[model samples]
Target: MLVRTGGPLAAVDPSEFTRTMARVPTPVTVVTTVDAAGRPWGFTASSFSSLSMDPPLVLVCPAKTASCHPAFVAADRFLVNVLSATQSDIAGRFARSGQDKFGDGDMVPSEEGLPGLAGAVARIACTLREVLDGGDHSILVGHVTSASVSGLDPLVYHDRRFTRPEPTPSLTTAG
Candidate 1:
């Protein structure tokens, strides 16, 4: 049996870890929320996924060093916009720091009053459930309150590039 300890795990180079993980395809998203003063804040993230169904939960990880981290940490609610295949520009812009992220992404106010990408393939508006500490990011667990889907192709990130999935022909047996 393997041993479990309270000590830190073996170290691995962050660059290598990132490069390895980049091989996996992930949906690109821009998570948005409002600050205490009602100012909009958001960040692009690929580390998001559905966590549960019974209570309808989703989680997104925002880097702790991100400029918008504090605002998200303090937000009571937030919106997660799953970018459409054509919205790679929005993903690129939101990933940077100290730039106009919402300038040309066709962002509009969501019904919940949060900044929302109008071209999202899906939109999930959630109430803050909990925030847990991940290695270099905060894992924000959200309780989904409302959601919408457009049935559009989603922007996918793979091998450090943005791409979309191409549908494969299905095989069916004739009766």
Candidate 2:
């Protein structure tokens, strides 16, 4: 447990803080976009979440240092591909720097012209709704124009490794 003393939070080193934060499990997702020349580009991200239901907004954060960051920022639209446990390899491919991540035979084009990875649990197509200029990373808020789900289990990340969730109560209970 993380115990908090009465005084100011003890100064922890950056590596320690990063490793500590990595302990929190996060759902894996692939953020895909088109570059200036209309070529496909994308990267894997764990920083994604639904923001609003009525407006159907979603959020994703891409690191400033990411090679595909410019492509995503420049694109008018993008797709958030939620990967399943079987897609850990896909996520790893996109996470690498300076490589033709999509060269693998797993990605396909979506109806909306964005690249969609095969066997993804869910794909959310969105237009760039907003961009918040955060330090070291940019927070992208998207308006979900279209979406689809495969109804499969989602892949997860924790402590710099891939993980899968244990079976839980289903939305439809046994009758």
Candidate 3:
């Protein structure tokens, strides 16, 4: 048996930890919402995951320095657009700063009026549930109001690059 101590888990350097974890693959997504002034705002993020299925909650962590951070924090409502493999360009567009991210995209509105990319693998509309204060970023938890899924492969992020899921071989028997 190995012994383990429970005292804040040995303060590992954050930069090193982040860089190390970035090596772990994650799914890429575009979180979108409208600001109080009704302008579309969005960001490409991989720090997103499903928190709960019962109450339908999801989490998206936007860095403090993100361009759309302010608008997202204020609106408290948003949509998680699960990008398809071919949507890597769109994700990159949103990730860039100093320009209107929604300018050259075909964004349509969800039932809640949040912007949803035309063809994502999945789109989840959510209302602000809670915002937890994290050191470098705020963990925004949203209660999913509605969700939709279109049949498509998801775009993934790994090794500091975008990736696509490879098709699996069918298990059908050939006589």
Candidate 4:
């Protein structure tokens, strides 16, 4: 069944929009960069995706109100550490504000001199390419300089909870 209202689209309720988006599954990642004083700053983000392959570009959205937003926007380089299923704790820690999120011993300095998590499923070192306005968030476009991946299941977020993908079942043919 379809209902036709020919005028204009109505604005969605913010709570409803958030609840709806919460149902969508997204990979968890911790985006990290070094501050001017060489201190590490990080925040958990799910709004990350590969934008292009020709120049090897990726984008991550950080809210304008985030405490580390200024550091990220001013940084020349950053690293995106794609969390593994075992990294839910790391995700939660970074998701919070006004704390030393890197107190845990899970981080190491990457070749690019940025913070990289040890058990991440993937790590992408990138140089800041562009910053675009995305409503209340900033779209950070990064030109990947180096990247690596591990054969681990990615941490996923859906319905406002952390989850992992179920393994696919094997199929057998009947003779």
Q: Per-residue lDDT of 47-96 in model 1, one digit per residue for the tens?
A: 99999999999999999999999998889999999999999989999999
Model 3 — TM-score against the truth? 0.88
TM-score, model 1 to reference: 0.90
TM-score of each: 0.90, 0.87, 0.88, 0.90
Compared with the true structure, all predictions reach lDDT values of: 0.93, 0.90, 0.89, 0.95
Model 3, residue 77: what's the lDDT? 89
Cα deviation of 143 in candidate 1 (Å)? 0.3
Model 1 lDDT, full chain set: 0.93
Worst 10 residues of 4 by lDDT: 102-111
lDDT-superior candidate, 2 or 3: 2
lDDT of 4 at 37: 96
Better of 2 and 4 by lDDT: 4
Q: Model 2, range 42-117, lDDT digits (tens) per residue? A: 8899999999999999999999898788877877899999999999989999899888888886889894888897
